[model samples]
Target: MASSMLNGAEGLKLTGMRSPHGLGSMNSTLHGKPLSKMGLTPFNLRKDAKFVAPKCSLSSSRPASQPRFIQHKKEAFWFYRFLSIVYDHVINPGHWTEDMRDEALKPADLYSPRLKVVDVGGGTGFTTLGIVKHVDPKNVTIIDQSPHQLAKARQKEPLKECTIMEGDAEDLPFPTDSFDRYISAGSIEYWPEPQRGIREAYRVLRQGGVACVIGPVYPTFWLSRFFADMWMLFPKEEEYIEWFKNAGFKDVQLKRIGPKWYRGVRRHGLIMGCSVTGVKRQPGDSPLQLGPKAEDVERPVNPFSFLLRFVLGSIAATYFVLVPIYMWIKDQITPKGMPI
Candidate 1:
């Protein structure tokens, strides 16, 4: 795909191919349901902060730079173990739909049956099923850390032809240049060092191969981070492009996928997704001419702000903590007079 094809929000303007999903028409209802149903709003109501250049500044205190909900290796293991039960039936459908997967796979041109593909962090094989739509299922491999999730994936008919393996995204078990296409979805947030994982994706793909990574976009508020960071990493648009380029991938472009379902109220922090695509270049090819270096958006440094965030996060956390207690109290108070 040419560089101009990824015109960001304008849409995938591929030449010679009049895609039913083309010309930024992926958002149109002709392709499927309304954007709201597919988990997209008409257009994001959030103000465009891209025009404002972020200032470079000195490092701040540890708490300021430190992300909330930082998970240790053990915490991640148990969290997914619990999540795997409800993941397929409850979680996967809300965000990553079949249409989103189609858009993510569009640039790869995977029509050839001979292409080898890998779905990194391919939990429950949701993404793997989508890959099989265009290419042979036997050509794909699904790698994830959770065996509980993998077991469910193995039971799916669409993924039966594919190979399943236990692996880490940052340190993949595959040899270098092993796959023609690399794709990951909804899993980047848990990566301890996401850039390292992106590098691994670049290392594993053959020259001119493409990788598509999908994840939640950064939420707008510190309070938002308190909720989201507990589960995933939400990198900004420029950060996604930067990670791909730094990993030596060419033609990096990012598209904001959706707000998903619509709400009547104009909410302060709307959730959006990002699909960042990049291609592996040939060994002797010239280095890609990258755009401006990514800038860090500065915020006011106040100890009181951190304290306030902690209190707010604590309150939210406490509310959930108190739910069972409240439920038990209600149960105790209510008289159970009828028994069969």
Candidate 2:
């Protein structure tokens, strides 16, 4: 653990990030949410002086740096824990719908009769549960980095064929072309090196294989260290498609699973995202490389969440903390454009 920390520190140092450890800590607390503006103290306000002035509009977006994947000896554990805690509180059986399961199952190419499926980021078998119900788990393996979270998932062992493997997403410990169908729900977004992981997925998938990655994107695009850290994961739609296709995924179709009966939990952070589906191209086939896809159609908030945010925003505004509290409440919910 100490060595890993040293490596993390060294990696931070290499990037020339100021107080990488501190930034990591702040990023950890922010989770997938952006920073709350109202929560800023006099000190934080002073720190943000460069942009807080009248001349700063915060209107124009700044250029985002392309990220190199972070290789950590330990697999990231926060996302798994986040799901565990979320399920603990809000198990809206309604939230887990057949449509989601059906849509989730759509990417299965059924490479073989045994159906060798690999489920990445199968926390508590949420995505795994949907897949097992739809196909043969006997040929399935759930790969995750956290033992504690995986163990919690293993307690039930709903299906005997569902095996769990502990490993990293960026550097998968598997042979190439080993899987027929690769489905990752709420997984790839967590990849510190998403491109590397995408390429790895391409390397492992058999020809004519289907690779569906449900990478996350926030509805809110901002400059908070909190937002930058995660937003870095959920790039624009084409950016995601290009990442996989560039890695050799053909017929790479990045679809937005929003609009129709979208999940309210998805737009937690004022930003909306889409579910991206890409397929590994057969050799010699020119992959689907197209111009930028349109953003998801406008979506209204769920009744419950909308009411809550309205109430909170109103209350916070009265207290002169509207921006901070509103952002906090927004971040507290799931991301918009409906991610899980």
Candidate 3:
């Protein structure tokens, strides 16, 4: 048993494999085995707060030099982290959808009746279990930025089948057109250039791949769900639809999953964000081949959207006159250069 050293930057249980000396120990919560290159050790089981933006709202702006999202452990505790956590019921077949009632739910083949899923930013393995029963773990990849979270996943995760890859969403370390299905489950919303993450998903998806995205659950009020980096940026469905188009995904379906309340106590669940499921368009695919592009997506516009903004603009102006700034300063603290 080699000794493990904690990397201050990431609260992950880094093993020796990724270390230069190859002397680091495996993650504590993972399978109690030697780790490979900060390797994956699956175990399983388990497990957000108020994300307040300062003068500049989260989606409003951030320094280019800064990471899109910072997972500050101590401060992130109060977050409603349990939204992804569903314990004990993961192995139950009764919980599966009608399509998978008789058959195993395979995330890898989401459209083909199987499921090869990569749970991007999949923290705590809550959703993985939900996915595992529906699909084979071998077909699932739990990718996230935190080793600590991955460690927790290892404890309850189905190691024999599922995998844990540590990497960033904007610049994934996988080859292009890799996964059959992809999901963020409300995680990618934290990425700095959320578009990049969407593009990466598009890049690594097989033709006809389905990218199911779930952003934070919030009401219609813009500021109501305007959280910090954890729930910081929310990209327009158009942005994702555009990236998928550019990256070769067709049949893009963007639909919002609204919030669910329990007994009138607003449970911070999925709401007010769109779930985009797009199929990767292959070479020579026709312009009229598949689904609608982001620009073409149509929904009944809530007339009040225009009215509310108009009213807020008027009322806020009455109490305190203000002028919106068109030219904003870009932060250069973080690397904004193109990804490798």
Q: How many backbone clashes does candidate 1 have?
A: 4
For model 3, state the Cα shift of residue 89 in Å: 14
Q: Rate the local accuracy (lDDT) of all candidates.
A: 0.58, 0.46, 0.42
Worst 10 residues of 3 by lDDT: 320-329
Model 1 alpha-carbon drift over 4 Å, by segment? 1-70, 263-272, 284-340
Which has the better TM-score: candidate 1, or candidate 3?
1
TM-score of each: 0.66, 0.56, 0.49
What shift in Å separates residue 14 of candidate 2 from its native position after superposition? 37
True lDDT of residue 124, candidate 1: 87
RMSD score of candidate 3 (Å): 22.0
Residue-wise lDDT of candidate 1 within 1-340, one digit each (tens)?
0111111323222122121212232333525656444443332211222211132221111121244432223334555676678776555454456766776566555767788999998888877887888779989999988898899899999889999999888778988888888889877766756777788888888887878888755443344445554433556555676678778986655544642332211111222265777778864322433333222123343556544544444444333233334433544565543210
User: Could you give candidate 3's per-residue lDDT for residues 221-308 as a string of tens digits?
Assistant: 3333333222334443335545555655544433322211111111122222334555566622223222322221134435565344
Candidate 1 minimal-lDDT segment of 10 residues: 56-65
Assess candidate 3 and give its lDDT: 0.42
Judged by TM-score, which candidate is best?
A: 1
Candidate 3 wrong stretches, greater than 4 Å: 1-115, 157-160, 217-219, 222-231, 262-272, 283-340
